[model samples]
Target: MRKNRNLIVLNIIVILGALVMVFPFLWAFITSISPGAGLSSTPQLIPDNPSLSAYVQLFDRLPFGKIVLNSLGLAVLTTGFQLITSSLAAYVFSRMPFRGRNVVFAVYLATMMLPMQVLVVPLFVEMKTLGLIDSYLGVLLPSIASAFGVFLLRQAMNSVPTELDQAATLDGAGHFRIFGLIVLPLVRPALATLTVFSFLNSWNSFLWPLIILRTPEMKTLPVALAGLQGQFTTQWDVVMAGSVISILPMLALYIFTQKYIIQGVAGTGLK
Candidate 1:
């Protein structure tokens, strides 16, 4: 009976926590639909007169479709490149035997500690030298290799049994063949988690794109959303609408791959 009471109390606390977490998003959506809704001290979850006027006005004021397409393209390309590069690097770090392997991996892991701000000037200079400044490549080149992704994937790969590799070797399979046919399939959950993470990071990235992309056409959603704020006055409803639209892809992606993310994260152990 004591255990049951504790469980009930825990359940109630969890339910309330869930509500608290969801309330802000609910308020944002309500504000988006409530035409001319200003920032309120007490936010309403339900608008008395809900409408899509803010959403309509948002598109009218900004080329949101093109911006969305640009963000989507950059995100897709960044995730694709990171997946390839991270998987190959992770495979090497986890599976290969070499002198100074541990030291090299440690050095690579240390790079993740460096803040991106510190590298911006040097990266920009390199892009300028290559004439990639103000282009998608400029925004993308730095993101193609992800240290976090490598660490996560390497951890996942470590969980895979070496016996499988030996069996594949006995079957005359090379390292590349084992990687493609044996290892990748075993780490599908980790790959899915990485894909979601890479997509989210690329989609929401602001500073790098702001520095690298010069034209309005190349602007990403976050930078474009920031533009909605005026020097003097801002439209809260329109900003809220843009916020709603911006979160949709991430929400959909999280809902689809949340299981994999949970599984992958739980299974991975730092080695």
Candidate 2:
């Protein structure tokens, strides 16, 4: 009876937390589906007419399909690159022998403490000097060397049993082959976690893309969404529509990855 009561309380708390977290998305959702321009007056929880006008207008005003493709491409590229670079770095830091490896790893980990804004100016100047200011490569370059991913993957790799590495090496496999066949498969959940993180970070990137992408064709969804906030007025309904679409991909990705992401953390076993 006491356990049942605790479970009931926990359920209530969870439900309340869910509602609190979903409030903004719910508000934006209702606003997007509502027919008229403004959602301020007597905004019911559900849409009155429930028209798709805002979403239609959102696409009409912007090339949404193109933007979605651009966002997907950028996110996939960034996530893919981060997985390779970070995993290699993690593998080397975890298992490989090298002079000053610990110190180098320390420096790499230390980079995570530096907020990205501190390096933005230098990065921007570097891109400008390379004539890549408005290019996709320019937007992606800064994010490729992900310190957080390296740290996370390194910790995950550390948790892996070294016996597996020895077994692979005994099979006449090279260090790279051992990593590819043994370590990577074992840490798939961790990779999934990092993949989702990298994808979301790249997809929702605003300030860097804003500075780098000058042209409409080059603009990402987040930067394009920023234009909805006009100088004198804001287009709430249409902006919300764009926002909903922008977030949908991330939501879907998260849903797919949540189990693996959870398992990944639990796999660390230091909890």
Candidate 3:
């Protein structure tokens, strides 16, 4: 009976936590439908007359579709490139032993300690020198390789048993074949986890895109959304509408990869 009571309490706590996390998205959705509502106005769980005027205004006033496409394109490219580069590097670090490999990897991992803020000026100068300013390539070049992704995938790869690689070798499988057929399949959960993280990072990127993209048409969703705010009187409803829209892709991606994410976290020994 006591165990049953404990389970009930745990369930209640979980439900309450879920609600707390969900409240902001719920409020954003509500505010998006509440036309002309400002953040200063009293909070209304349910507005008197909910309409999509804010979304309508957003689309009419801004090139929201193009902005969303730009974000999606950049995010997809960044995630794909990161996955490829990180996976290859992870494989090398985990399987291929070489002189000074550990030292090199340590140095690479140390780059993660340096925040993007510190790299911005140097990256901008480099982009300018390369004449890639205001181009998609400039925005993309910096994000193609991710130290975090390499670390995560390398951890996952290390967890794979080396016996399998040896057996594949006995079967006349080359390093390329073994890596492709054996290791890659086993670490799928980690790959999915990396994919989600890479996509999220690229999607929400503001600083780099803000600095590189000069034309309004080239601006991604986050940068474009920032333009909506006025100096004195901001439109809360429209801002909320954009926020809701920006969230849908990420929410969908998470929902689709939820199982893999859990498995990946557990497999990697991460809390």
Report the lDDT tens digits of candidate 3 across residue range 131-175.
Answer: 999999999999999999999999999999999999999999998
- Please report the TM-score between candidate 2 and the true structure: 0.95
True-vs-predicted CA distance for residue 210, candidate 3, Å: 0.3
Flag the better candidate by lDDT, 1 or 2.
1
- Candidate 1, run of 10 with poorest lDDT: 38-47
Local error of candidate 1 at residue 19 (angstroms): 1.6
Best by lDDT: 3
The per-residue C-alpha lDDT of model 1 at residue 98 equals 99
Q: Best to worst by TM-score, what's the order?
A: 3, 1, 2
Please tell me which predicted candidate would have the highest TM-score against the true structure: 3
The weakest ten consecutive residues by lDDT in model 2 span: 35-44
Candidate 2 per-residue C-alpha lDDT over 1-271 given as tens digits, one digit per residue, 9 for 90 to 100 = 9999999999999999999999989888888887665646566797658888888988898888888888899999999999999999999999997999989988888988888789899999999999998899999988887988988888899988999888877888998898998889989889999999899999998888999988897789998898878897777888989988988899999999999899887876534
Q: Candidate 3: which stretches are off by over 4 Å?
A: none
lDDT (Cα, tens digit) per residue for candidate 1, span 1-271: 9999999999999999999998888888988998878886467767788999999999999899999999999999999999999999999999998999999999999999999899999999999999998899989999999999999999999999999999999999999999999999999889998999999999999999999998998899999999999898888899999999999999999999999988888878533
RMSD of each predicted structure: 1.4, 1.6, 0.9
Models 1 onward score TM values of 0.97, 0.95, 0.98
221 in model 3: Cα distance from truth in Å? 0.5
